[model samples]
Target: MSSPAIAVENLNFSWQPDKKILSHCNLAVPQGEFWMLLGTNGSGKSTLLRILAGLLTADSGTVELIQPVGFVFQNPDHQLVMPTVGADVAFGLVSERLPTPIIQQRVAEALGAVGLSNLARRPIYALSGGQKQRVAIAGAIARHCEVLLLDEPTALLDGDTQLDLVKQVQHLVKSRGMTALWVTHRLDELDFCDGAFLLENGRVVDQGDPQILKHRLQTTTV
Candidate 1:
C-alpha cells in the first residue's frame, strides 16, 4: 500500500507556554484522498493547516509529510501579488531558476487545470472573487505540490460562488490525484469529501465518513 500523504503523532503546539493551541493531535491522510477538517472558530483548524504546510512548527511531537504542500489562504488577495493572472501563477517557478519554456508550460497547464486558461492575461484586480480564488489555486498547481492545504477557502464568497468554487477544486484535486486537507466550517461541504475529522479545543474528537459525522453532530445538537 502507498504511504499516507500526511502523518501527525502526539503533536503539541502553543503560542504561549501557559496556553495550548493543539494538544496530542494525531491524524493520517492517505494519498489521493480528500479530507475535511471540521471545527468551530478557535478549534485549531487553521493552526493544523499551518503546521502541515510548514508555516509553523510544533512545539513537540512529529509531523511526517511524504510530499511538498501548497497552501491556499482564505483570502485570495493575501496570496496574489502579481498584476496579471499568468504572472502570479509563474512567480513561484521563476524563483526556482527554471528554463523559460518550462515555466511557461507549467503556468499554462496550471491555468488550464483551474479553467482559467482564457483569463491568463487578465488583470487580477478585475476578476470576481471566484475567479481570484481560481487564480490562487492555479499558482499552487504550477508548483507541482503533491498536497493542497486550504483554510476556509470559501469563507469570503457568496453562497452560490462558494459551492461553485468547492466543486471546481474538487474536480481539479481528483484529476490530479492530489491529497487535500480542507478546513471548513460549512457542513454542507462535507458531502463531497471522502472522510472528515472533527476538532474541538485543539484536539481531534472524531474521525469517519462525512455523512455519519454530520448525523452525529445533528443528533447531539438536538
Candidate 2:
C-alpha cells in the first residue's frame, strides 16, 4: 500500500484532567484516497480532525500528515471571507503570493472542478448550501492542498445536498489524487468513500472498507 498521507500514533487529548477526549487513538489514511471518520456526538471526531489540521494540539501523540493541508469546517460561513465565489476561492491563494495570472487560472480550474464556473461572479449569499460548500472546497483546490481535512462539512445541508457534497469530495479525491479525511455522521455518505474509521471514545475501534463500516454502523447503536 502507499505510505499514509495522514497518520496519528498514540494520540491523546483532554480538555481537563478529569476527562479525556481522545485516548491512545491511532489511525491512518492512505495516500490519494478518501476516508470518512464516523462517531456519535462528542466522540472526539472533530477534535481529532482539528489536531490533524494543526488547529489544535494533542496532549500526547504524533501526527504526521502531508502538506499543505486544507481544512473545511462544518460551516462555510465561518471560512468563506470574500464577497463573491471566485474571490473567495482565490483568497486562499493570497498567502502563496502567486502571480495574478496563476491565481486566475487556479480559481477558474478549482471552480470548474466543483461545477461552479458559471457562478464565479455570483454573490456568496445567492448560492445554496451545497454551492457554498463547493466554493469552500474550491478554495482548497485553488491552494493546491495535498491533504484535505473536512469536519462535518455536510452537516448543514439537506439530504440531497449532503450526498451531493460527499460525492463531489469523493470525485475530487480520486480525480486529483488528493488525500481526504472527512468527518461525517451520515451513513449514506459512506457509499462515496474508499474507506472509513469508526471513532469511539476518542479511539479508533475500526478501520476498513466503507460498506462494511456502514453496515456495522447501521446494525449497531454507535
Candidate 3:
C-alpha cells in the first residue's frame, strides 16, 4: 500500500522551557485525503501546522511528510507579497527561475483553479477578503505541492463567503488528488472534511467521521 501523506509520532513542542504546547501528539493523513483539525483557542493547532510546514522545529518527536507541501496562513496578507494577483501566484515559480512561458501557464492554471482568472490583474488591496484568500490558495496551487496545510483560513470571512471558499478548496483538493490538513474551529465547516481530529491542550483526544465527532463534541460539552 501507499505511504501516508503525513505522519507524526510522539511529537512534543513548547514555546518556552516550561510552557508546553503539544505533548506526545500523533497524527496520520492518508494520501489524497482531507482532514479537519478541530480545537479551541490556544490549543496548539497553528503551532502544529507550522511544525508540519517546517516553519518550526518540534522540541521532540518525529514528523514525516511527503515533500513539497503548501501552507496557507490564516491571514491571506501574510502569504501574498506581489502587488497583482497574477504576479503573486507566480512568485514561487519566478523564484525557481522557470521559463517565462511555463510560469505564465502555471499562473493562469492556478488562478483558474481558484476562480480568480478574471481578476488576475487586479491589485491586492482592491480585492475582498474571500478573493484575497483565493489568491493565496492559487499561489500554492501554482507550486503543485503534494499536500496543502491551511490554518483557520475562513476565520475572517462572513458565513456565506466561508462556505463558498471551503467548497472551492474541497473541490481543488479532490480534483488535484492532493492531501489537505485544514485547521478550523467552526463546526459547520466540518462537513467539508473527509475526516476529523480533535485537539485539546495540545493532544489529539478524539477522531473519526466529521458528523460523529461533531455530535460527540456537542453532547459532551458543558
Candidate 4:
C-alpha cells in the first residue's frame, strides 16, 4: 500500500481542559484518494480538520500531511478575498513569486479544473454559492496542493448544487492524483468518496468502506 498523504496519531484537543473537542483520534488517507469525516454537530469534525491544516494546534499527538496543503472553508465568502474569480485563484500563488505567464497558466488551469473557466472574470459577489466554492477550490489547485482539507465545502449549497460540487471534486481527485479529506454530514455525499471515518466523541470509532459507513450513519443518527 502507498504511504498515507494525511495521517493523525492519537490527536487530542480541548477548549477547556474539561471540555474536549477531540480525544486520541487517529485517521489516515492515502495519496490520490478522497475521504470524508462524518459526525454529528460538535463531534469535533471541524476541529480535527483545523488541526490537520495547522490552523489549530493539538494539545497532544501528531499530524503529518503532504504539503503544500490547500484548505477550503465551510463558507467561501470567508476564504475568497479577491474581487474576481481568476484574481482570487492567483492570489494564493503570489507568495511563490512566479513569472506572470506561469501564474496566468496556473490560474487558468485551476479554474478549468473546477469548471469555472468562463467565470474567471466574474465578480465574486455575482457568483452562486456553488460557484464560489469552485473558486476556493481553484485557488488550491492553482498552488498545486497535494492535499485538500475541505470543511464542509458544500454546507451552504442546495441539494443539486451540493452533489455537483462533490462530483467535480471526485473527478479532480482521480484525475490529478491528489488527496482530499472532507468533513460532511450528508450521507448521500458518501457515494463519491473512496472511504470515510466515523468520528464520535472526538475519537474515530469506525473507519473504512464508504458504503458500510453510509449504511451505519443512515440507520443511526450521526
Q: Candidate 1 lDDT, tens digit per residue, 1-222?
A: 988899989899999999999999999988898899999999999999999889999999899886667889999999899999999999978768999999999999999999999998899999999899889888889999888888999999999999998888788778999888899998899988889999998989999899999899888879
TM-score of each: 0.97, 0.97, 0.97, 0.98
* CA deviation > 4 Å runs, candidate 2: none
Per-residue alpha-carbon lDDT of candidate 2 for residues 1-222, written as tens digits (9 for 90 to 100)? 778999999999999998999999999999999999999999999999999999999999999998899999999999989999999999998888999999999999999999999999999999988899999999999989999999999999998889889989999999999999999888888888999999999999999999988888788865
What lDDT does the true structure give each of the candidates? 0.91, 0.94, 0.92, 0.95
lDDT of 3 by residue, 1-222 (tens): 889899999999999989999999999998998899999998999999999999999999999988788998899988889999998998888768899999999999999999988999999999999999999888889998889999999999999999998999899879999899999999899989899899999999998799999888888884
On lDDT, the leading prediction is 4
Stretches > 4 Å off in candidate 1: none
Candidate 4 clash total? 0
Could you tell me the C-alpha RMSD of candidate 4 in Å? 1.1
lDDT per residue, candidate 4, 141-174, as tens digits?
Answer: 9999999999999999999999999999999999
Q: Predictions ranked by lDDT, top down?
A: 4, 2, 3, 1
Candidate 4 local distance difference test against the native: 0.95
Backbone-clash count (model 3): 0
